[model samples]
Target: MIGQILINGLLNGFVYALVAVGLSLTWGVMDIVNFAHGEFLLWGMYAAFWIWSLVGLDPLISLPIIVVLIFALGVLTYLIVIRRVLKVSGLTALLATFGLSMVLKNLTQFFWTANYKNITNPLVSNKSFKVLGMYIRQDYVVAAVGALLLTMLVMAFMNKTKTGVAIKATSMNKQAAQLMGIDTSRIYAITFGLSGACVGAAAALMASFTPIYPEACALYSTLAFVIVALGGFGNIKGALYAGLIIGVAEALGGYLIGTSYKYLVVFLIYLIVIQIRPRGLFGW
Candidate 1:
């Protein structure tokens, strides 16, 4: 039973890490708190659900399209909203994102309504396979694998590509990057795009099993804030580790205590860790 719980937690941790990574990029690179980040995930899920319902494509089959769409949304967000408030003040940027979040949530509710929607069937069947006396759901396994692959892709992009390097430079010092002809505005747009891409992929992977609704990702958004803080601001690797920890903690807490208090355990651990290392586990 413990082993099974561990497996479930590990799988969930990967997805959580993917979701938090997107928020990490925008926060770490642009120093912009995107209150609308969760809405991006909500939209991605809606996109996947609608495509599956209308076009008869599996979420996995439609994954790439959804990712690209969210990427465009991210770029548009930077250009249309974030860019305007970029220099006004941190508070202004924060407020802008908050307002944007409201707009997005309302738009979704307006078009789709507050009712929950879900994909009845997906390529990955809702079946579990037993291995070494432990059962793992196919959807969970696929989601976990996809999340890991996507996370690695993001890491490689940041480390290997010229644009990635420029992004890193801008994160470290925006003025310096601009002086070096890095085109900080373009980098910012790309960062937001990348952030949205991460969440979009996650949405597609999760759509097989997760319910679709405007508020579906609300809890995820809150947990993401905690994960980002626990992982250390702007540290992708840290976010991965922190996500796993939270996933396991949540599962164990639910089993050992109760589902009602599972999240309490998550927050308690975060509080204790922050007291010891105020900069977070990976923060500099």
Candidate 2:
């Protein structure tokens, strides 16, 4: 019984982690907190919906298209809006992002309306597998596995590859790295684009569990903020760990208390953590 809750929590948490890590990648690399991150995820879900509807591609399978589109969007945003603001203080950057967030949100609502939306597929409804007595639906399984694989891939790239090394270098010390012949500008562009690509995957995973609504962009935006705060800013590993923690907390809170009070506990923890150690558990 306990194991089932844990597994269920973990699967849910991986989705949150994917979202947080994408946000953190930008923050860690460029000190940019993209308030528009969740909106990117929202748009990707819509993108997946259309592709699936028109071409009969499953949302899972249409992931590449969603990713490419969002990635391009991220790159364009960097070049057009974010590039000029990068040198300012964090508050200024956040203000720009917040404005962008509102713009994207209103744009989505304008085009799509505020009605609820969902996608159907075999994997989402299919009876899949049982792991540790937890009913592992196919969508959950695929999302978890995808999240894990991507996390490992990013970690491996950062740990072993040349460009990845450059990214890490830029993240840690931009000026020193620029002196070493690394194209800091290009690194920032790729980092934001990669983060946006990850947001696409997050959107696809979210479609399996929840309806896509205009408010989803803001709701998940707050959730991502909570997870990032809970886990610690600019800490990918911490975000992963924090996701499971928040997921478990939310699951247990909903089960033991009420669903309405779930975020209370999540945010309470966030406040405590941020108050005591603002840098975060793993923040560097």
Candidate 3:
């Protein structure tokens, strides 16, 4: 039983890590906390759904397209809406994103009628394998592996590429990066796009098994924020580790204390961690 819970939690954690990494990146690079971040994931889900419905493309097959589309949307958002608030107060940026979130959610509900939808006949649907006396869903495994690979790719991009280095530099000190001849605006746009891509990939994986709805992003978004805070804001590694911890913790808590109190346990941990280490486990 314990092992089964661990496996389930770990798989869920990988997905959470993927979702939170984008939030970490944008926060690190632009110091902007996007309240609309979850909406990006929601849009990604919708994008995958439409592609599958219209073109008969599997979510896995359409993953790249979804990522690219979301990336473009992120860049456009940066150029159009976020750019104006770049120099404004953090509160203003927060409000802007919050408003964007509301707009996206309402628009989704308006068009989709708050309906819950899921992919039918997905490749990984209704498949499971037994391992060490525990049954593991194939969809969960695929999503976990995909999230892991994408997380590594993002880490490599940030650590190995020249553009990634410039992004890191900008995150460290925007004025210094500007003085060094780096175009901060472009970097910001790229970062937002990358973040969107991360969420896009996550959404695609999730759509394979999870039901989609107009407000589907709400819980995931809240959990992403909690993971970011638990891991430390602007820290990718921290987010990854924190995601796993929270995942396992929630699973265990759900099993031990009942599912109703699972999230209560998570929030309690978050509150305790915040009180003890406001900077988070790995926040600098």
Candidate 4:
């Protein structure tokens, strides 16, 4: 039971971390909270689904397309809409994004309806391995491994590259960095696009784990907010910790209290944690 719980928590946490990393990155550098972030993930899911279903490509193989499509959408929005919001107050920016979220959610429903769609990957149901006396699902393992690779790559990119350094500088102190000659606007745009790409990859992988639905991304949006809050606003490392904690809490709570009340348990714990630390467990 213990091993099973750990495995489940880790995989679920992996997805949560992947999705929230983008949010953290954007919040860190741009200070523009994007309520529309998950919609980009949802777009990626549909992108992967359509690519696979129409072109007969494997879901994994279509990841690039998913990333590109969502990245382009993000960049376009940055140039057209978010650019205007950058100079506005945080509340205005938040409202701008909230409007975007509503548009994307409703647009998806209009086109796709609320029916669930999935990429029929057999590895999920067909393959598994016993790990420390627990039968671990191969698909979840794939998701975990994929999430790890993506996270590592993002971290490495942020740590070693000049562009990455600029992003961090902006995140840490935008005004100081701007005075130092860094193009703050460029950094903001790059951050948005990259964050979108991260969530896009997450969405593609998430589709492999479960059925895709229009409202699924909407659900993930709330989860993303909880993750960012639990992890600490604008802190990727904190997001990681928060994701694992929430994942384990949910797993254990579902086991003990039934899945129906699972969300209540998550929120209650989140509230308790926030009370103890308003910024988050690892707010910078």
Give the best candidate by lDDT. 1
lDDT of 2 by residue, 123-154 (tens): 56656587656676677778888887776677
lDDT accuracy of residue 262 in candidate 2: 81
Please report, in order, the local distance difference test score of every candidate based on alpha carbons: 0.93, 0.81, 0.91, 0.82
Provide the global lDDT of candidate 1 against the true structure: 0.93
lDDT tens per residue, model 1, 46-139:
9999999999999899999999999999999999999988988649999999999999999999999999897996999879999999999999
Error of 4 at 183 (Å): 1.1
lDDT of 4 by residue, 54-122 (tens): 987766777778877887888877888789977876498888888998998899989989888877863
Of candidates 2 and 1, the better by TM-score: 1
TM-score of each: 0.98, 0.92, 0.98, 0.94
Candidate 4 segments exceeding 4 Å error: 122-126
Among residues 3 or more apart in sequence or in different chains, the pairs in candidate 3 whose N, CA or C atoms overlap within 3 Å are none
Deviation from native of the Cα of residue 20 in model 2, angstroms: 0.5
Ranking by lDDT: 1, 3, 4, 2
User: Model 3 off-target regions past 4 Å?
Assistant: none
Query: Worst 10-residue stretch by lDDT in candidate 4?
Result: 118-127
**Backbone clash count, each prediction separately:** 0, 0, 0, 0
Q: After superposition, how far is residue 103 of candidate 3 from its true place, in Å?
A: 0.6
